[model samples]
Target chain A: MSDPIEFYYDLSSPYGYIGAHLIEDVAARHEREVLWKPFMLGAVFKEEGTQPLVFYPKKGAYARHDMARTARLHGLPLNFPEKFPQLTVNAARIILWAGHQDQAERKRLSLAFYHGIFGEGHDISDKAVIRNICETHGIDWAEAEAAMADPAIKDQLKEETQAALDRGVFGAPYFIVGDEPFWGVDHLPQLEKWLESGGW
Target chain B: MSDPIEFYYDLSSPYGYIGAHLIEDVAARHEREVLWKPFMLGAVFKEEGTQPLVFYPKKGAYARHDMARTARLHGLPLNFPEKFPQLTVNAARIILWAGHQDQAERKRLSLAFYHGIFGEGHDISDKAVIRNICETHGIDWAEAEAAMADPAIKDQLKEETQAALDRGVFGAPYFIVGDEPFWGVDHLPQLEKWLESGGW
Candidate 1:
C-alpha cells in the first residue's frame, strides 16, 4: 500500500457519518488502510461563507430526508438527536487524544463516538457522555478529559482544520487519496474507481 | 411505464452539461422516458441567498476542477466559455419553444443548446448564435428570435422554474423520479438504484 486514504469528517456532519460507515469497508476491499481524521467542518464553513448543507432552504429538507434514506440503505442505525448539528469540538479533542494512544484505539473510539452521537442519538459532546462511554471501554477517563485542555491537542485540531482548508475541504467527508482530493460522500464512487485504476 | 423521469437542469450550469449528456442514456436502459426540464437556476439561487457553487471560496476552486474531471469521466466535450455562468435566459426561451414541439426535437435542441454554450464555448445568449444553431436544424431563424420575445415562452420558463422550486429543486441537474427528488450528478447512482429497486 502506498499510503492510507486520508478521511476527514466532522462529528456533527450527517454525511460524515455515512462516509465513516462506508470508507473503511471500501478501503478493506482494496487492501488499503484508511486514516479517519476528524476535523472542524464548522471552522471550514466559517471560512467558506457557507452553512451546513442541511441548513440551506429547500435543499435543507432534502438533506435531512436523504440522510435518513442513506442511513437506511447502508443498514446503519441513525437516530438523530432532537438537538442536531450539535457542537463537535469536544468530540474532536477526545478523538485527537485517542490518536496519541494508538491508531486502532483512535479508530475504535472515533467510530464509537460517531455511533453514540449519530447512531444512538447520544450527545457525545457532553463530558459525562464521553466519560461513560470511555469508562465502559476501559479508556482512561481522566486522561481523555484532560486531553481537551492540553494546548498541544488544541493546536492539533487547529492545524488539522487549517490543513484541510488548505486542501480545498469546504465540506465534511473529504478524502485525499495521494494528490487527488474528493469531497462529500458523493465522491466515494469516483474515489473507488481512482483506487481501482490507480488514478483515473 | 410510470411517468417519465423529470430531469431538471439550468443551461448555464456545468453539472447540467454532464446531466444532459448522461440522463438520456441512463433512462433508456430502464425503458424510461425523460422530461428534460430547463429552469432558471439563477432564480433558485436568489431565493436561497446562495450564488453558483463555483463562486464560493474554497469550494469554487474544487468545482472548476471537478467539472473538467466529470466531463472527462463522461467522455463528453466541455469547453467552458470565456464569460462563464453565462446569462442563459435567451437560450432557455428557445428551449421552452422547442419543448412545444415533439419530445425528440426538444431533447435535440436542449442538448444542442448545452453543446453550443458548454461544448463549443459559443455565447448562446446572443441571438446570432441561437439563430445560427436553430436555423441549421430547419427552425426558422426569425421565428426563434420572435419566440424569445414571446410572453408565453417567458411565462413557460418562469412556470418551469417555479414548478421545479415547488418540487424542492435547489440545484442544477436536479431530477425527480415519481415523487422522489435527487440533486447533483453525484446522486445519479442513487437515482439508478431507486429506479431499479423501485425506491429503497
Candidate 2:
C-alpha cells in the first residue's frame, strides 16, 4: 500500500475549508489515507518574514471572489466569517486531541469548523462557538476545552506549527506527497494525479 | 448589447496567457465582446509600489506548480519560458498596431507570443523571432516592423500602459467590465459569470 498523503492546514483559511471537503473525494479516488495536521497560520507567516495581507493587498477582494467561485465550482455554501483570521489556537488543540482519539472525528471537527466559519459566518474565535461546533459533532466539549487549556497541548500546537514552517510551508492546505510540497487548495488535484500515476 | 469587457494584459505574463485563452471561451459562452488592451507590466508594478516577485517569494515555487496544475486542468502544454520578463515593448507595440487593423489578429498574436515565450521557451525579445512569428501569421513582416518602430505607435503603447496605472491596474490580465476592475487571471471566471448575469 502507498504511504498516506499528509495534508497540513489552518482553520482560519477559507481555502482550507474548500480543501477539507474536496481532498476527501480526491483521496478516496486514489485510495490514499489522509493525515490531517491543523496548525497556526500566524506562526508560519511570522517565521517566513511576511504578513498575510502584505503579499496581496487585494486579497480581501480576491478572497471574496474566490469563495464565490469555489462555491459555484463545488456547489458549496461559502460565505465569509463574521470575524476572520479567528483565533484558532484552541481549535487546533482540540483537533490534535481528536486525532489522538479518532482520525475520523478529527476530520469531522475540521469540516465543522470550516462550515461554522465560511458557511454560517460564525465567530470561530469565540470559545462558545467552538464548543457548539464540538457539541454538534458529538465531541465532548468539556474535555475538548480542558485539552485546549493544557499547557502540553499548547506547546504541541506551537511545536507542530514550527515544524510546518521548517518544512517550507508558506500557506495552508499544503499537501506533501514525498519531499515535494504542493501548497494551496488549488494544488490538490495535481497531488491526486501524482498519486494516481504512482510517480514520486 | 452591453459594453465590451476591457481586458488589460502584458505579453510576458504566463497567467495572462492562460487568462487570454480562458476569457475568450468565457466570452463566447456568454456572448460578450472583449476589447484587448496590451500594456507594460513593469511600469504597472513600479506605480503599485511593489514588484510581483517581492510580493510573494513563495510565488516562485507556487508559480511552477500553478503552471503544471493549470496545464493539467486545462489539458494544455504550458512550457514555462526560459527568458521571462522579456522586453515586451515591441510585442505590446505590435499588438496595439494589430488591434487597429484586425482585433482577432491582435488576439492571435498575443497568444502566439505567450506560446513562444511560455510554451516553446523562445526569446520573444529577439526581433528576428518576432518577425518570424508575424510572417507565420500572414502579416507583412516589414510593415509590422515599421509599425513597431513608429514613434506614434510606441507612444500610444506607453500612454495605454500609463492609463492602466492611473485606473488602479497594478497587475497583468486586469479585466474591467464597465468601471469595476478585476485583477489577476484567476478572476476571469467570476468576470464571465458577472457578464453572464448582465454585467456587474
Error of 2 at B173 (Å): 4.0
- Residues B59-82 of candidate 1 have per-residue lDDT tens digits of 988888888888988888989888
Give the poorly placed runs of model 1, Cα more than 4 Å off.
none
lDDT of each: 0.86, 0.78
- The complex in candidate 1 yields a DockQ of 0.79
lDDT of model 2 at residue A55?
44
> Over the stretch A103-171, how does candidate 1's per-residue lDDT look in tens digits?
677678878888888888988668888888888788788898889888999999999899888877888
**TM-score, prediction 2:** 0.78
Model 2 has fnat of 0.03
State which candidate has the highest DockQ: 1
